[model samples]
Target chain A: MIPIVSDLAPLVCGLLLAVTGAGKLFGRRTAQLAANTVLVRVLNDGRRAGLALRAVGAAELAVAAALLAVPGTLLPGVATAVLGAGFTGYLGYARATAPESSCGCSAKAEGPIGVRSFARAGLVLLGGAAAATATDPWWTEAARRPGWSAAFAVAAALLLCAVSADLDHVWLLPLRRLRIRLFGNPLAGAADGPVPVAASVELLEQSVAWQAASPIVRSALLDHWDDEGWRVLRFAGVYEQAARGARPVNVLFALDLGASIDTTSSPAVRVSVIDDDTDEMVPVDLLAGMATRQVLPMAT
Target chain B: MSHRQNDPGRRGLDRRRFLTTAALGGATIVGASALGGLDADAAFAAPMPSLDPAISRSAFAEGRITQIKGSVLEVAGSHGDQHLIQLTNATSIWKLRTTTADQIQVGDGLYARGVDMPDGTIAADAVWVNIVNLYCTVKGIAKDRLHLAHGAQDHAVVGHIVADTTTASYLGGALTSDLSRVRIGQSAQILGAWRPADDAIDIARVTVGH
Candidate 1:
């Protein structure tokens, strides 16, 4: 039973390596990963990085093929151990030096290096070491005793899937979604009432006043406040027509909440340019004539 | 806030339904009002144009240049898709600056946005070479480089400051090529060209302060 379990480790690792290697070799993402990630910096240049990735991929495929076909070969087991160790070391280096870099272990796996990546690498290393002690191939051992061997293989694969953060969408996310559906999403009732600031901001963005003032506005959403039944949204803008040449001013839009009207369609939104230098409000009628224009002019 | 606001019940209608109805009705009212002096009959009779959903509006592609044959560039996408990009006189190619087409090299990461041609080639109007805009936090500062934590995951990023190109914008102010003011733990937005194959980026501009 010990030998059978040990042999099964190499089999699982071999399959995992084969998938990962195939992704590196044939997948379109390999080029980007090689070029954009830390591989280039560590490996010297882009061309070298590409070559290195391909070589690793090729080596992995060869080892996987050897392990799967030869079965009881000690050479493949030793090679697997070395490869796993190398992966662990490299991942560690990447994590410490370039945490922003993607692992590039698999095609679909594109995220910053994290603990799960470290775990996955460590798992491979452990599997390789365990396989080195096996007397016979897992398949042959399983053929002799079917029940426990099958169970071990299934358990090992499931464990690998669980540790692989890249494969989470496959098994984990769906389970989470189902659970949410049954129990209801916790955030569903978070927003009860009283118009959110985001909603107010969205309404401001869609307003005609915003369109007219956007060109002069240099800064985004400087400050916002509610005053006299109106939500005032302020932005930093250049007041070009100032007496003392062009100067920065606070552009405020007063949207009436009392009207209970969609500000997007409402023509009553008032605009004011406040000069900080003099503390004076300059009312602007930039969008005054816009309301009388033709509406819903062909969707094209 | 009043309980009436909390209850979300207005004029005997549910909150969601009321909001939806008000939005739609307001839009209709606005449209009618925008018709100038046009009568209601003319406003209702106006023809509404149909939008074609099948139209492909894909204007951006990011990947490495695999093959460059004449004015055509064969790009291998980050995903398992291949893209052919055509360069014209109007197509502006930028590496670190406003450069010509000759600067574009194979194995260089790029982002091109333009009209997708009928023959599946993208007629690129603009191509930014190795450009990356990152919202990062200053984790540490060294003599030569600044260690940054970028994205929601706080991924480590090394930013190399170019003497000529690297500039800083403080508190929505004008850009200045001074690094002395930059401090640790400050959140910064950096625009720079990514060094191919490296986790490091050459900083062009750093904007600090919200």
Candidate 2:
């Protein structure tokens, strides 16, 4: 069993690596993130990035196919090991330079795209290739070895399909559940008491054009809430309309009023009063339409 | 490990010389005979199919053409898994049920049985192309070939128009006169079969060209 698994493991690793390569070529977000690592950043432009990924994917698939088709040969085993070592070298380089930087691998999800994973994949491939080359003869006592090898290869191919999709979320869900169980709350930072009333608010869409009027006006807007004893939150919402443009295209800024706000409902307005201890919309003396456009900074 | 490091030549002479002598003796014996068994094995290096073609043929006969997409045919049987058979200028053509190579098209389902080629593909002798109708647009046109792009990934189907049946109706529009008559931006709904190969589409239709 050990020999069988050892002989088959590299083939399995090669198959998985090929799938990963294909996924990267197809612009999978995870695959893209992986490519975005510092080493890949050396390649300029998105087109080049895609081409590099496709070339790598094709090479990986070819190697895997070769390993399977031409077994009992020392040449393929050595070739696979060389490829693995090259991958490991790249991983090491990435670790040395950008240890904390996000791995912009094509996968949209954030995960540890670290050197360890690459080293693991490489070593597995090398081991399998070596074992396959040095396996027992055809007339060994285990007459069923050939059948078993064929079966394992088929299984590896099927698994390769799943790996290609980058849908390993199914496998990682249990890990997430365990982490959540160990940790009391995942989101401790945002769990503060009732949010303070915003110092000032503006229609974010119009704020852009309004800010262009003067740099001073923009600076004033950013600084106004800092002077006031209130915290501001930038809110954004999307709404579905029965008829197009029926929804109100406006945002209301409530001053320092301790108020309840519904974060979930889109297109629903929440009322808050500045410097007031109630949920009511407090009246303010207008400094023209610009005062209404004044926005409070969250840091303040 | 230390033995090899210390005195490798002694062991090498024993194993290597003995094997070489045995191989030479076997080669001489087979070289001197008309039956020509073991020498042929040394020369060939790889095992060919069994001497009895009937046994190999019987094993190959079990695969059915599971799906067709353009020039690529998918055969599933004896192998117990779908194997893609790529057809090109070099592929030997065959007919279904001993009929001449007619009645073949994209989407024509088939059951093909043949010998497993040394390269691990089936060399089908009998191909039963299943005929199924497909509606797609002319994604691209190359000389005598039309490329139909379809489905989520927008797979491309490439094929030349069947002789004489050149006119085709596109997207519920009137049938155009011929493949040449259809414009680049025109939509086409073709009644034909599709054969799926590796990332390819093979279309065979009775009516095309819109």
Q: Which candidate is the best by DockQ?
A: 1
lDDT of 1 by residue, B75-187 (tens): 99899788898875435455654456777889888877556778888876457777788898776555567778776445668999764446566663334555656666678
Q: Interface root-mean-square deviation for each candidate?
A: 18.4, 41.7
After best superposition, candidate 2 residue A27: deviation in angstroms? 7.2
**How well does model 2 score by local distance difference test?**
0.39
Candidate 2 chain A least-lDDT 10 residues: A215-224
Candidate 1 lDDT tens digits, A1-300: 278767777788789889988878777767767775679889788878877887888888998887787767677878888888898898888888987777776655456877777788888778777777778877788888889888888998888788775565478656655654676543233222344333454455555655555544543344445554666555545566546676645566666543322333554556666654453555455555455542566776
Q: Is the docking of candidate 2 incorrect, acceptable, medium or high quality?
A: incorrect
Point out where model 1 deviates above 4 Å: A26-29, A107-109, A208-220, A235-252, A258-264, A270-300, B1-210
**Leading candidate by TM-score:** 1
Q: Which residues of candidate 2, in runs, are more than 4 Å off? A: A21-53, A97-120, A124-165, A173-192, A197-257, A260-300, B1-210
lDDT of 2 by residue, A1-300 (tens): 366655665556555555555555564553345454564566656556556656666666676666666655565566676666766665667667765433333223333445435645555456545645646422231355878887766865555433332343344334444554576322223223333221012121122222212211100111111113322321111122335422111112222322221231111122211211121222322223445544555574
